[model samples]
Target: MTGRVGIIGIGQSNFQPRRNDASYPDLVREAVVIAMRDAGLDFDDIQAVVYSLSPDAMVGIGNAERLGVDAVGGRNKRFLRINTGGATGISSVITAWTHVASGACDVVLTAGADKVGECGDSQTVLNKIWDPIYERSLPLGTINMLAMSAVRYAHKYGMTQEDMARVVAKNRRHASKNPHAHLRKETTIEEVMASRMVSWPVKLFDCCPQSSGGCAMVLASERYIKQRGLEAVWITGLAHSSETYYLGDRMGRGFTADHADAHALGASFRKSFRMSGIKDARKEVHVAELYAPFSNTEFHSIEAAGLADIGTSPAMLREGAFALGTNAGAVVNPSGGVLCTNAIAVTAMVRIAEAALQVWGRAGERQVKGARVGIASGNGGDHQFFGTMVVEA
Candidate 1:
């Protein structure tokens, strides 16, 4: 997709452990109304809609998008649903972008919601993502899979317990400023380290809380934005990649064993940068909203996003390099990020929304001053699905 594809509106529902007051469709409506209001348009103006979410098992409903079609005003429009696990949100946005960029539609709405907490035994449900014969018998799910990466990261980079703790503490503090974040209280490194361990090196505090939430965005072509006199953030470049199906494929002998380095992520970032002509990511990128559900994962995510070197994130992190409101470097995860909120389906889309808000100067409390270039990414499957995008003010 080429040309100027602009995000003219963004909205999100309040993130929490549960939203008993509203049904799935209701949540979708809430976000769609807010996004439509922001864009100063109605359903009549939308030419198409892209609804996204994870698998049916996660929400315990087959064809979940059907429930939200009317909510997004997709009754008679060209409506479609997207699924790529955690990457669904961002992937949906990119799909909408292509609608206008390809001259298929002048305006499109992309929205979705997830009630991960409402689902029965979310952990048990996620285990289905693995291959039935090769990987299902191990009793593994999302947390321990990433924990393996954390252990490998620690072994490769010599990252300490305190280093991982710092990542959690920083995001917790940042979440305090984000009104829509699921977890907003400030936390200390001691608090994080003292929390019950879910897996070795991945503590309770390190994990993202399962929340019920919805997010929506309105996208338009350059002519549409100019004609409407609306403020917009441009999608300069976007790319996504998938690793091999089985996690074992990502591991081999030597330093590359365990695939802790996130080589796929690095490849995704490099492809996006090359497409966007981003030669110096460290200097040119001003803010990043990376989808790291765990503390230690942030190190690899940060490095893979092209914000730092493979082994240098921990040291840079200790120096306040990725902290919000930093004077000398990019402010990472100003919206507290996935570490503070995880609504599986909408998680990755929230990253794109937060990045766009920073670029649009609309990220009120958590805005990074003079943010020009922002980046966002999503991780899904066994780190199999990856999405990356660069947004410019």
Candidate 2:
């Protein structure tokens, strides 16, 4: 763990509903070129490649990573593909970090991309990730599953639909400054409230849009960093955990499984904080890019990350603790988060990239002042998978 691995360069495409102009490989290449250029390296300088993508069933292509090897500059180098539902992006980065930290390679390229819109009705495909028998018959999709969480949170905390709308408004406002975000228009609470409802408690605007894009990052060891004299953000610690595949399995266990999720995340955060040598996460960490495809999930993430006690995130939000430039707390999702830009497969990686940029002093207008420590998280598989990472200047 002491062998340092840092992100020297990061690049992403302009996230949008569709990208008819570029093939999937072209999208990957766009981010790769920028990342390599930013790192001041050519394809030959990379020792290995770690590519991330969701199921081939969603993209209508089998062995998709094999097709992308050339574009990712992995034609002759060691290549590995990762698939962990939505957690693929962040998990891929963690894998690459290990390759460099273990000295198996000095530099590795990590990238992910998705074309959910191009595949037609991504929801239908996502539905297939669930178990084929008992759980698949409830007409339950991602929206319905999240709706259940929204209802639970609302009843538990006395939250209203308008509160969720406020979250959308705030994230969209943040997205307006992000050129690569999928939805960049500023939104109002009323506008979000008025949006069509996908489920009882979840509205259309409350849900993340189907996005198509790619992102790439160049990771190097401490030796590589010092040799190149590159401004870098070190990956101090990383962890991932997965839950049971079926919701009923989790429920019969008396919501203990959800607590297990919290425990796993808590362990990850504790390890990362210790590794980074930070005593107070809320005080030492200046920025956070959390993956919340739904507004209420943001509250869940706040509690899971140990940033707030259970049932207190809404109060924190009302107090403006999570807002940008607030002295009381860290800035959460300054890149509009998943609420503003959800690239399906690459959403988590985007969060990692955004957090890295903030720590590297390259976030432009959205950068947090004196952002020395940052955190990024990814949730996947019907909220069953979670990954957290800590980065430091």
Predicted structure with the largest lDDT when compared to the true one: 1
lDDT of 2 by residue, 330-362 (tens): 888989999988777688889899999999888
Residue range 1-393, candidate 1, lDDT tens digits: 446999998989879999999999899888989999999997899999999788877778898888888888898799999998888898999899889999999999999998898887888888888889888999888999998888889998999888989998999899999999999999999999899988897999989999998999999999888988987889998898878776676667543324687777778888989988999899999999998998988999899987888888999989988998788678889999999999999899999999999998999889899999999998888887888999999
The TM-score of candidate 1 is 0.97
Best by TM-score: 1
Candidate 1: C-alpha lDDT: 0.89
**TM-scores for candidates 1 onward, in order:** 0.97, 0.96
Model 2 score (lDDT): 0.82
Model 1: CA > 4 A from native: 254-258
Give lDDT per model, in order: 0.89, 0.82
TM-score of 2: 0.96
